[model samples]
Target: MTKISTFQVEDANTQIVDWLKIYAENAKVNGFVIGISGGVDSAVTSTLCAQTGLQVLCVEMPIHQAESHVTRGREHIDQLKIRYTNVNSIQADLTSVFDTFKSVVPHTSDILKVNLALANTRARLRMTTLYYFAGIQGLLVAGTGNKVEDFGVGFYTKYGDGGVDVSPIADLMKSEVFLLGKYLKVPESILTAAPTDGLFGDDRTDEDQLGASYDELEWAMLQDESKKSVEDFSGREKIVFEIYKRLNFVNRHKMIAIPVCKIKK
Candidate 1:
C-alpha cells in the first residue's frame, strides 16, 4: 500500500496554501467561505485557508446534526483565528423545504427515496447558505472534499458539496488529508473524529454508509487502477474491491463534468 510521507504532507500544505492565494487574487475575491462539518477534510481545508492569511468565513450549518458534531465544529473554529458564524437555520429551512416537497408529491411513497431526497436537500440548503455569504462578501466557496471521495468513489452530493468555486484538498486522498490535518495542527478532537456528512440525523458515519474504511477503499481504488485481477486479491481485498466498484458506479456522475449536447454538423 502507498503511504504519504511527512515531506509530501508539508509539500501538499504549501501547494494548497499557494493555490488558495493565487486563485483568490486572480478571481479578485476578498476571501474564502467554507462550510465546517467538524470532519477532518473541512478541518484541514479551513486550516490551510487560514494559513494563507486570507479572510476565511467558517460557517457551521447543521441539519439535524448530532450535538457532538456541532461541538467539534465549534471547537475547531475557536482554535483558528479566522472569522466564523453559526447559521442555525437547519430546523426551519430543512423542515419547510421537506414539507413543501411532501405536499407537492403526496403520492410519493418510497421511504428510502424520500429520506435520500431530504438528505440531499439538507446539503443543497447548506450550499445555498454558503453561496449567499460568499456573494455578499465577494468570497469564493471552498470545498472540503478529498481525492478519494471526490474522484475515487465520488462520495459528495451533486451540486451540494460538489458545488464550490475552489477545491483545495480534492487532489489529496483521504489518508493524505488526515496526514495534512495532523501537519496543520488541527484540533485533536477533529483529527480523530469519525467523518460524517451531517445530513443523517442518527449520526451514521461515512464508513457506515460506504461499507468500507477509507484505508481499505483507498487500497482497492489503487489496486483497481493498477489493473490487478480479482483472482490476485485476498478475500478481504475482494470485498473492498466490490464496495469500491459499487460506489464508483453509483456516484460516477458526480466525478465527471456535466454532459453537453452537441449540434450535428
Candidate 2:
C-alpha cells in the first residue's frame, strides 16, 4: 500500500468532500447522517462529511455494545462537534429494543445460526434508526465501509450497514482509511483500536471473525485480482488466501444487486 503522506490521500479527501456536497445539493437534501462505530472508517467518513460545511449528524446507536467501543464513538463525535459547527451527535441506546425483538422472534436450536441472526438484526435495527433520522432531518445516510470490507470480503450485513444512501470511504482500503483518519486528526484511541463491526456486542476483532487481518486480506485481494490460483501458495499465505476466497465467494451476493428475474422481452 502507498504511504499516507502521498498526495493521493489529500486529493481523495478533497474529492470525496466535493462529491458529497454536490450529491446533497443535487438531491435537495440537507446533509448526511452516519453511524459511528468507534472505528476508523466511520470516524474518517464523518469527518469528511463535516468538512463539506453541511449539517452532519453523527448517530451512535449502541445495542449491547462494548464499553471501549461506546467510549471511543462518543469521544470521536465530541471532537467532531467541537471542530465543526455543522456537526452534531445523538446517542440512541437500543438495548431494550433489541431485547424486545429477541423476545418476539422464535428461537433457533443452532447457537451459531441464532447468534449470527441476532447480530444481523442489531445492524438492521441501527440502519432503520439512521433512516428515521434521515427522513425527518432530510439528510442522506453516509456509510462507513472501506474497500477491503465492502468489496474484498463483503464483511457487512446486507440491508443493514450495507444499506445506505452514500458511501464516502468505499474506495479506500482499511490501511488508507487509517491514513486519512490520521490526516483528519481522528482520535488516537480509534486509530489504534482493532477494527470490529460492534454488531455482536463483543470484543472479537474483524480478524477474529474473518480469520485474516486487513493487511493480509488486502494482499489476498490483490493476488486474487491477478487471478492467482490456490495451488500457487503454501502454508499461512495459502491459508489466508483461501480464507479470502471463501469469504468473497460466500458474500458475493451482498456485493451485487438483487437478482431480478427478467421476463423475456
Top-scoring candidate (lDDT): 2
Model 2: residues >4 Å from true position, as ranges?
1-4
lDDT of 1 by residue, 1-265 (tens): 5778999888888888998999899999888888888889888888888877777888877665788988888888887753333211121234455556657864457888878887887788888989988898888999998888988898888889999999999888888888888888888998888888878678688999899999999998898889886778778888889889888888898887789999999
Looking at model 1, residue 244 earns an lDDT score of 90
List lDDT for all candidates, in order: 0.82, 0.93
lDDT of 1 at 31: 81
Worst 10 residues of 2 by lDDT: 1-10
The sequence of per-residue lDDT tens digits that candidate 2 reaches over residues 1-265 is 4345658889989999999999999999999999998999999999999999999999999898999999999999999999999999998988999999999999878989999999999999999999999999999999989988999999999999999999989989889998899889999999999989887777899999999999999989989999998999999999999999999999999998889999998
Error of 1 at 203 (Å): 2.0
For model 2, state the Cα shift of residue 213 in Å: 0.1
Per-model RMSD to reference? 3.1, 1.0
Query: What local lDDT score does residue 246 receive in model 1, on the 0 to 100 scale?
Result: 85
Q: Given candidate 1, what's the lDDT at residue 159?
A: 89
Candidate 1 wrong stretches, greater than 4 Å: 82-107
